[model samples]
Target: MTVALWCILIAILLPYVCTWVAKISGGFRLKDNHDPRDFLDSLEGFGRRAHAAQLNSFEVIPAFAAAVIVAHLAGNAELVTINVLAVLFITSRLLYIICYLADWATLRSLVWFVGIGLIVSFFVVSV
Candidate 1:
């Protein structure tokens, strides 16, 4: 598969990674499985930030996946360009999660903008 396609898979999995981090940090118990949302909601500090990051990660998947798929189907942009943008988006997301957990609000927002910009670039390049 193309690197961009691989990125879609990575993007789909990213939220779960964040969720895992939140659960681990929040001391999730087996009993908490019955009310995972509540457990996650009860988290604070870095745990809360991790949960927020998970939600945000999930929120962006559709757009990112669609952008990658559309870019591939449209077949206008070079494979290298698409792959690079996809990699950059994933990198931005990783940085975003770190920033979120570290409480770097400004840096996190900047990284978020970069991710969104990369998504837009996929569409732009497809044209």
Candidate 2:
């Protein structure tokens, strides 16, 4: 249960972390003339990657959240299974963020698949 809670916490904070990375990456300004799209477009390199990561983070949340909640509620999984998988998923997501920021494309994609795999496994256990 605690592991599930921690994973929930991670999910909640992940977006803010991504947003912070995007903002701090570089090339953003407070110019009045720029619209949202232009402001986004002005970002380059790290900022651009961070922005993409931010968007990607949003994309994964629904399925992951559903998997965790449904599986946990179904009560088929042992505590150890839940805890280990939660740790693995969270760790993969953390690494994915780092890899994205570092522009490690290959590693980023791999970790993303790991995260997805973890989520799907969660669902599988529930069913």
Candidate number with greatest TM-score: 1
**How high is each candidate's TM-score?**
0.98, 0.86
Question: How far is each candidate from the true structure, as Cα RMSD in Å?
Answer: 0.6, 2.3
The C-alpha lDDT values of all candidates are 0.97, 0.80
Q: What tens digits encode model 2's per-residue C-alpha lDDT throughout 1-127?
A: 4687678778768967877777766644577235755665668889888878878888888887787788789898876787778788888888998999999999999999999999989877766
Stretches of candidate 2 exceeding 4 Å from the true structure: 27-38
Clashes of each: 0, 0
Candidate 1, after superposition: displacement of residue 93 in Å?
0.5
Best by lDDT: 1
Against the true structure, candidate 2 has what lDDT?
0.80
